[model samples]
Target: MGLLLKEVEVLVVGGGNAGFSAAISAAESGAKRVMLIDACPEHWAGGNSYFTAGAFRTVYHGLDGLLPIVNNVDKAMVKKIDMKAYTADDFTQDIHRICSGRSDPELSQILVHESNAAVKWLAKHGVRFQLPFNRQAYEVDGRFKFWGGLSLKTQDGGKGLIEDLRRAANTLGIHVVFSTAAKRLGVDARIGSVRSVFVQTADGIEQEIRATAVILAAGGFEANSRMRAQYLGPNWDLAKVRGTPYNTGTCLEMAIRDASAKQAGNWSGCHSVAWDAHAPPHEGDRLISNEFTKSGYPLGLMVNTEGDRFVDEGVDLRNYTYAIFGKAILAQPGHTAFQVWDSQMIPWLRDEEYREGRVERIIASSLSGLAQKCAKHGLTNPGKFVETIAEYNEAAVAFQRENPSKKWDPGVRDGLSTQSKTKRLSLAKSNWAVPLIKGPFMAVKVTCGVTFTFGGLAVDPKTAGVISSTSNSVIPGLYCAGEMLGGLFYGNYPGGSGLTSGSVFGRRAGKAAAAASKTWNEDIQLLSRL
Candidate 1:
């Protein structure tokens, strides 16, 4: 017995950042009824945005204009990094570079142009931000920095933003259902359009939801190892190590199983593998710190089972991490890299609880404690570890002494500190240094934990509908945005672009769906009357 599901003007499947925007945008655009259905099993509390250091990259905002040096160095460092330096030519070039020519140019253009307004819209929705400051080069412009505009991650602020959006949806009479997970897209075979969606509620009651349009913003599958191996290659270990727990690639299965869908760009998946061995459940210090220069934290040398410092530890984070990941792929057992840091980094670790996101720290009082931490984590012998630390320290001391006036970037600078503050402590006084190094040491195992899967469904910008590559026509009533839509990221993702792209495309999709709803309502109502 088939149940005649209740109908809505628009159906958004997911409750994270993107889905929230999609439902809100649809209601704001005059949709008679908008419904956002999410499993939110525990709560969509920690998706990519929560774990991620929230950033959005766009070209028109003038971030590129401010720090051309950072822009130039970024270009020099990585040839394929997407550079949307506000110039149409540069933006297009970056898009092509990142996409590797596997994207719809028209859709890419629309994303670039609308990003600025998308950010502003977030602010309008009560997602307040810190005062903007100039950082490195921005997405398209040089003015967009991490501080440009971002809501503080307060319980009131973060939850309040979502509540405000939900309230707005309620005022417009949009249906917002919690604990409802979209099982799959219901496609009408007779007309070849999205008819409804299958949902499973908290009590395990399976229900159907009929809609005029289905916007699939259910996120990607970074947590699924089988999918990771399928898309990323045979060697890729898709561990549930990082990113969101709900992102098990269920959405990707929905797309692949459907015969009508066409997959799109695979963004820069070949980046670093981020795994936190000391992460939660069993471990206390859940800080999976990265040894990247851009991460703004000092990193000691990273070694494989062979105990060799492979790449330049002081290079740009992406460059160093990419190199390490490559080495990790070849290393014994593969996908595991040992991060060796001294007690000097303890301050950063202790203060981590107050900070948001992943923070891992392991304490030890003696050499035996250090060895035990390594042994417990399945690390190789700590014998070479001591030698590696000493060599690096010696090199750092020499480098800092020779380069006194150079106010160097933290990541690129040799691990030695010539800064007046660090100089006062001196390597002799530091516990992690050679003579005093008999005490505490820490190491974390890393694999590739992701913020969101960069890949997603393909769509046309003009209509916000899934496009058929063979026919070049819109897949009627099937739309996507946020991490669910692919090709917005070309090569390297600009910091804030992920959230910004979600907002931009979500609004565009909402407006289009609202306009299309009129025809849908009349047809459905006629069918009901009959």
Candidate 2:
């Protein structure tokens, strides 16, 4: 086939939240021609964004501040809800704490400070927001108390988020072409600036599309087994994917290989979680989506094949710990673990992930019976499992007796722990420690589900322009956002922060690209006059 050519003021590669954000922002910022290309077909248009819970961790002024943008709460519901303000400092602390202070200071500050404005911009483009009642809040004392520092989500989660973004893009007249994969970044040798992109269509035809500016928001290499094994190390090739199969890091590779983009952030780290062991290994189920996540470990206990507890399950709230716990599970024997909860705590498990039919559950009336049932599913030592429960129960009961005032409140760090001055176990449940006395016990098998990779290109925090690895400077007309633009996260990630980071930088990249495109046009006109 002949090399087909096209021209646009701005070209965006990737169709997830970040790409859509950039396309919309570019169009709104006065770029007349903005085109977005996705490697997947129209059916797989949203990339990983479609599989998200659509939760966005942004700085908000509590209930009154978020009410103006959210659509789910009524006056009665609002009266029953208690939410605290999440300030820029709070957001910054969460990022730093979760990432172990390895997050880039400049990038994190930009993300934290611009988060509220980014969400507001998304809402202005018709994306609906709502309080995350089911995921981030718990009912206590006839009221819904929000916790985890995450209060907002899209109305229908990721599906709704993508739909709204697509609607806004179409309304803004941004051209979207599916089944087009970006293969290379075409740079002008004379100017050392991005001037074109070589792409491949579905029919095996290659084309070079010239553009004044290009924005890369094509996500990470989570879905690529080869790349995952290469960067994330041993057995990552076997980790189940939690999102799109299309995010194979094509555009990210193109930027690095062709534009000499500097790589940044944690190459070995990723956002993973305790997913249903039975879920698909290579790709995420669009219908089931985020339901595969098993985040209720904080409300219960997790045990490996040896029936021994490995990590402190209640060390922190689920938001802060869930992302890293998946790696812990993967490191265990058989790369699997059982999340055990009694009838008393089962009711609190979110229906989206733990409902009766959502995942296979093993139930038993006694702890011994539960252990025996788990043995059939790879629990190597039933006797040790029963013993572990007994020891944990004794520690928990003794701690409760020592500190009677400490209440077990899942909504806060209530100080209900399994460690006491006189009596302590090898490992302790730091908070919400309740003895496993109530039975009709239930357990679900879980394995690691890789969400997104943390390693990506380095960019200017202010402009979101990709930095050249050789020159240590911005690659003039090349910009990036979302998972492709890293340095914001390291060892772990705070829940709901990925989507927020995407929008925060996507907006910046888009606005800057549009302005740069306009300048390029002006320079061309001046040269023509000369």
Candidate 3:
């Protein structure tokens, strides 16, 4: 028999942003005893939220509305900034368009509508917010122009985000146990309600903790190679994990097996990106967390080992296209691709990712020389690589000559395309097209990094209660949030939307779970009198 621990009013599993959000929200919503557990050690606490850039997409009324919450901007600097209000309609359309209208309509609406309130609530809890100046804005015409519908980020990115959340959780007196893995859910057979959780500590001591309500925000199965191969299909097991190695879908599987949880969303789909080919395979680097991301492909071109351009790199803004491009690269020969850019675009690349010591850079003075250098890396046909660049340059020059009025602008979709009436390349760049005339080109090798799996347990939109697969009804004491609660995203995700979705549903689940705990106490009291 396992050791039985003290009962708690609310129990949260997972220590990422969503778990912290649920734990903190539960404490604030009148839950007296709240406890959180994480499988990872103390140092590996934040799960995937620690590897993000910390950008949050929220609906705001232009610069005026955001000025209050953001900490980086001031009265003087705000004068030169160009920002537009992101409305609910715009947010809704972006999710629908990016997911190809497959996102759950109710979940999408809740995410968009509650985004601002969620951010504000996080701020109230001491999580700092700032404008993502370095990542989201580009200085054009001596003024900072922000695009991609993302304005706020944590001050020091994901590291600071986790630190703030930990501080807030501590302040609320919420107990957190690290290196404790939840083994299974203890369900009451009478009503099929979750009553306790069986967990094992690092020292191999097993214990059962009774709880009034249990919230599962433990995350998806991206880090579990077996689950990835089983659910996400062939070669998915080979994909590098972009986050914590501890999120192996243990809680997700436990809930499904023990409580008959219904699963939903794109099982084969996930959020992936072009990552440094030399990065670690199983986990993210704490010091260089998100910098392993190679998102500057939109400013350049990507070619496979066959030395052929496989994707139209400039199909959309980096925020809109970066996630899916990793899958495109993974599908290429050798599961790798190279992003190439000339001297003109080199200065425009984000320094955190393209800086000299950050990534392995291949440099050469001419296209042939660049291709030859890439051959040493992985390029199989250097001659074809040179020919591809020559054709693209020719089409770019022709399009510019025919349409001289259209100028290349990286801030928006300037429509400096490589397609024209007289001349058209087989794969034309849709925007920010410019001839690579300057010498000294640069390239970087990249592969796929899976962020999180899209498939997860189906839950009620209002309360985030886990829906039973058998009875098709809500489990009395089972709730889910964050990536564990899916159907909000499908094929592709809008940048910064994951964090917002986590916060929104995490808060809802926390509040609802707290209320359920109160009801459980009242019922217990009535049964005692009987």
Backbone clash count for every predicted candidate, in the order shown: 34, 0, 0
Instruction: State the TM-score for model 2.
Output: 0.98
lDDT of 3 by residue, 150-266 (tens): 889987888889999999988998898888899999999999999999999989988898999999999999999999999888888888999999889888899999999999888
lDDT of each: 0.54, 0.92, 0.91
Candidate 3 residue-wise lDDT at 169? 88
The sequence of per-residue lDDT tens digits that candidate 2 reaches over residues 157-250 is: 9999999999999899888998888988889888789999999999988999999999999999999999989999999988999999998988
Q: In the order shown, what is each candidate's alpha-carbon RMSD? A: 9.1, 1.7, 1.8
Could you say which candidate leads in lDDT? 2
lDDT of 3 at 282: 94
- Pairs that collide in candidate 3 are none
- What's model 3's TM-score? 0.98
Candidate 3 residue runs with Cα over 4 Å from true position: 1-5
Report the C-alpha displacement of residue 380, candidate 2, in angstroms. 1.2
lDDT of 1 by residue, 362-449 (tens): 4567644665576566557667655655655554565456655544332222234422333432222111122224346665555444
